[model samples]
Target: MLHIVACIKQVPDTKIIKMNPKTNTMDRASAPAILNPYDAHAVEEAVRIKKRYGGIVSVLTMGPPPAVKAIKKCIEIGADEGYMISDRRFAGADTLATSYALTKALDKIQKIKPVDLILCGKMTIDGDTGQVGPGIARRLDIPPLTSVKKVEAVNQEEGHIIVHRKIEDGYEVIQSSLPCLLSVEKEINEVPYSSFPNMVKAARYEPHIWSVDELEDVNIKQLGLKGSPTIVAKVWAPPKPEGGKIFEGTPKDQVDQILSVILEKNELFQAKGGY
Candidate 1:
């Protein structure tokens, strides 16, 4: 059976998010969280592939225990199993740190069932950096394909997958070897409705959680903020422009006054150029 693994993330719903005036960081507790919208499409595509190819679908996520909500979402989407890697050591991770942690989890997953394919959303809304997918492929020494819009075929024996990748203006058809990672565009697939049984399973699902100790050759220094090369040096919201003072007048008087001001400002039209 084909083993398709999709990586998903839990993110703060930024629509209503408030920012700290002093620190300029999101007030996470004030905002409700949701499964990343882009990852939803990726999960749907993976489930679709699993249904057609007759394989088990698994999901992997590296986040806090609260992030298990995203894993359950995958269960509702038809994944057979969900794995979550969570540790306090993984806090304050940037793309690089996050990639390291996720790669460690990927290594763990590979030990059980050699993953045939790996899928990810185009990018996370919060981070907006799509580096993790390619980073995983590089770490695993496999091909990484990005912005994929369609999956043409997958041949297990040949160990290759054919796909259409989003390009500058259109798309490019490309082929890559199996055990490949793909970052997919939102147009890849439509999310299907959850059946009663799957919904029930999703509601009760408890994901397999792994800590730093379980992964192989994991460098503790590289797992979270400590391992990250990039740091958020500082963040501040743009100062809101002071509200403009509106001159109140009738339409005709307002128009006349506006034109008079403009004419007076122009030296050529003003009677006296100075004063």
Candidate 2:
């Protein structure tokens, strides 16, 4: 049976998050935390693949204890198992450090059951760097196929898979050997509402929780903030745009009103020597 592992994360809902004006940084408290949207799609796709070919879909994540909620969310989406590596040392990790830590956890999982395929979201909504997936692929020395829009086939006996990779104009069909990593696009699959049975299972699920110590061959210097090298010079929210005027009238009248407003603005600009 295929053992597919999908990497996931719990992130602050960016849509509802607010920025701190004084610190010019995100006010994480202002928003509720949820499973990363892109990662959800990745988990959904993995579950779909498992349904197509007989296999177990497992999800892995790294975060605080509360992140177990994210794992439960994955279970609600039909994942067979969930693993989370949580520890205080993993706090404040940048993408590079995060990848290093996850790789160690993956090594332990591999020992338990040989992984046939690894799937990841194209990018996390909070970070948007889209680096960790490729970073893990590089560390494992496996082929990383990114921007995958479709999984055409997974030939287990032949030990190969075919996928449609999204390109500028359209998509390109590419085939790769097994044990490859795919960073999938959201369009690859539609995530449906969780089934009642899955929801019941998720409610009672308790994922395997591991600390940094549980992972084998871990580098203490590469676990968290201490290991991160990327320096964020500053973080600020874009200035709110000025409110717009409402042109209330028929189409022809609105057109005339718009032209009049444009002329008025032009005259003011000329008066102010704005050319």
What TM-score, over all chains together, does every model reach? 0.86, 0.89
Name the weakest run of 10 consecutive residues (lDDT summed) in model 1: 266-275
Residues 1-275 of candidate 1: C-alpha lDDT, one tens digit per residue: 88998988999987877788788887889888888888988888888888777888899998888998889988998889999998899998888888788888988898899899999999998778898888888888989999999999988888899999999999999988888999999889888788989999999999999998888898898878888889877665568899864756899988888887778668565556555
Q: Give the RMSD in angstroms, all C-alphas superposed, for model 2.
A: 3.4
Error of 2 at 22 (Å): 1.3
* Residue-by-residue lDDT tens digits, candidate 2, 1-275: 99999999999999899988898889999999999988899999999999999899999999999999999999999999999999999998999999998889889999999999999999998889999999999999999999999999999999999999999999999999999999999998899999999999999999999998898888899879988999676788788899999998899999999999999999999999994
RMSD of each: 5.5, 3.4
Question: How big is the positional error of residue 43 in model 2, measured in Å on the Cα after superposition?
Answer: 0.6
Q: Report the Cα lDDT for candidate 1.
A: 0.87
- The Cα error of candidate 2 at residue 76, in Å, is 0.5
